[model samples]
Target: MLKIQEIREIIKLVDNSSVDEFSYEYEGSKIELKKNKGTAAPAPQMVQAAEEVKQPAQQAVQQAPAQTEAAPVQAEESKPAETTADDANLHKITSPMVGTFYKSSSPDADAYVKAGSKVDESTVVCIVEAMKLFNEIEAEVKGEIVEILVKDGQLVEYGQPLFLVKPE
Candidate 1:
């Protein structure tokens, strides 16, 4: 889930940073933390070092309000986009997790895949970050990314369409 480096960075921030309790507010998710130099820290630290994560552990603690607020924003944004749906011959590529979708590895970087780009079963389409885990989602079929169903950093539902692929 979470990459080792990202976790280590968080841990280092907690351990070395004076902001013992830091929070990040995204589109619809709010991650809050209350670091109590206790036993919980060790296990989380170990878990963080073992994987390359995309989200923060504090996500679970603060996602409720954020999720509620985000719903309306996405709903409004999808209105115009849904019009493109009339071209239903395309296949929908949905998300496997309830997390934030990242189109690229980092900010200011190009997306991993884009509309009109051809892809194969082994091609990585995007990354989903959930509870501090950065999971990679690959194209299961050989096709072209005809449309991106969801916006980058948007909270996606399990099985929610992320892209529209026109198979080759």
Candidate 2:
């Protein structure tokens, strides 16, 4: 028989490793752990180009003619670089409280800030729903989003890094 803590440790170990399947048996008690290959890490940086609330409209109104084609290429090139940013120079937007994180004001609306989206101290970066109340989370630093650390509708813990930003 395995203790609860031991089982939890086993699960974490299996989840972080490359092994896709695991099984164990002791004293007629059996345990099995499997990683779901279908679920890509819940990171949202890959879909950033399609996100960005108030970003596209603002950019289109300002530099549409000059950036129309270049923006698409930039997005593709940045995909590879997004994974290698130096965290030492980045500002992290962390969850202020334990709650469920939401990327938009509503399900159908665009996300507040995606990779490459610029943000200021007052910018609403995400929503944290706690105790039936939706609290809007703000980005307190001025910067461009370098990565989105949390997935939409995911549970977040207090002080968990939600987004990584490169200061402007």
Encode model 1's per-residue lDDT on 1-168: one tens digit a residue. Answer: 333234335645776766657654444443344466654322221212222332343333234544534544564466566545544576766665468999998899899999889999778899988876677787878999977877889887544678778888
Off by over 4 Å in 1: 1-87
lDDT of 1 at 97: 46
Instruction: Name the candidate that leads on TM-score.
Output: 1
Backbone clash pairs for candidate 2 read: none
Number of colliding residue pairs in each model: 12, 0
In order, the Cα lDDT scores of the candidates are 0.62, 0.64
**Relative to the unseen true structure, what is the C-alpha lDDT of residue 46 in candidate 2, on a scale of 0 to 100?**
9
Each prediction's TM-score versus the true structure: 0.52, 0.51
Task: Summing lDDT over every window of 10 consecutive residues in candidate 1, give the lowest-scoring window.
Answer: 41-50
The superposed Cα distance between candidate 1 and the true structure at residue 54, in angstroms, equals: 16
